[model samples]
Target: MKLLFNLLAFTALIFTTAANADISENSLAPQKEANFAQNYLDRFMQRDFDYVMSLIDTEVAGTISPEKLEEMHGYLPSGKLLSTELIGSQVKVINDNWEGSFTFEYHFEDGWALASAYMIRTEGKISIAGFSVYNTPDSQKELNRFSLSNKPLGHYLVLTMAIIFPVFILVTLVTCIRTPVQKRKWLWILFILFSVGAIKLNWTTGAYHIKLFSFQLFGGGAVSASEHAPLILTAGFPLGAIIFWFKRRSLIGQKKKTQKSQTELKESDNSV
Candidate 1:
């Protein structure tokens, strides 16, 4: 029993190690990359457009003119740079190439801007890929939450469906569980758990998209990448649940026929 316990513990450790190896980390950039990013930003704020262009990849630099880079820089919040903080950094390594993005919050005397820099590493060479600066925070909380003002008719309709569709599915599920169906009742339960078609609505923009082939598990719900990200409301038709309810009576009838047939066979056997 001691040997068996040791073997089980070893197996669990191996499985845990393998699982941990696959999870990506939002790690800090390599020292070289970090220095390059900071220096580029420093030059950017100093309005030294020439030095910034030199750090960009040759292909990207060819596409950007001095005048265009100046125009893009003009969009950044205007003020003296008070401080800079690295808000987030994450990198994806694909074979020999590294793709990463670093976002910094630059605080100025007047305002703040979220500046993001994309970098690529290939064959031991690193260069700036792209950059963007947003003076206004691109967050869901910054916009309206539950108000229905000025929304399109479809958004309103889909939002209403999203609100009530899950309750309808739950009611049907409870009814299915209570119904008297003898054979393969679990199959019916699984079938009743999926929604067949979907309508998606953007909570912030109020834009909507419809998909006829979408199959959503557990029916209608809302999902978002982060708290700062916009909530996406999805409402799909509970076709499976509806079908189960429609044929439940037939299923019960089949079960009764099966039971009656068995009883008749037992009665005939008693005469022998």
Candidate 2:
């Protein structure tokens, strides 16, 4: 009777261990998905096109070669990533197939852009099958207007504002060193350039948009590719202005000091 009881207890223990093991495996599945998704995103942001391509399925991989992938990567900003958020996800298992949806945020052009991607898992690996920009209807229209309007008045206004404000602030900063007023002016110019450039890029690339306004304005037109010249002019003007302005001020101060010293020496000789 003691042997019979021992055998029953050991059987119960084995069942319990098996149940625990299955539960642990189930819990780990979602975590693995999240980690792999995030790692893939990191590689995308870093422009590691080869690494990203390797994670994708062969059919998708064949459509976009490494060179084409690298070309697309070139268009993306090389700015440091600010943060990432796993906004939401859904996983489905049917028959022997697994599919999932993942939504996440990326810091692009100094602002947050949201993207939703659909992934398919086969053989314990995930690959992105599709992606979409998360933007409202109105925002889409506004972005289209910003990009494709190309109306002479709008173009001139944008270009003029982009150039004139930075130059004015730079000049003011140079003339009034050591004054809080100058510092504030320079800071404002920098802020304006940074924000405007970010918005422009986001609108052009469909990276981010004010949904309600954009859709109303744009209808169904696609987002434009970013214009390299405009972006460069917008960002570079303010930066160059700041640097040159400071250098000019320093040179002017040295010249003034030299003149003052020469006048004092001449006055001393006259006194003698």
TM-score of each: 0.74, 0.36
Q: How close is candidate 2 to the true structure, as a TM-score?
A: 0.36
Worst 10 residues of 1 by lDDT: 18-27
* Residue 107 CA displacement from its true place in model 1, Å: 6.0
Tell me the tens digit of each residue's lDDT in model 1 across 181-224.
87777887787777888988877877778899988765676665
- The 0-to-1 C-alpha lDDT of every candidate, in the order given, reads 0.71, 0.48
User: Which candidate ranks first by TM-score, i.e. highest?
Assistant: 1
Superposed model 2: Cα runs more than 4 Å off: 1-29, 74-78, 131-272
Write down the worst ten-residue block by lDDT for model 2: 213-222
Q: For candidate 2, give the lDDT of residue 117.
A: 60
- The number of clashing residue pairs in each candidate reads 0, 19
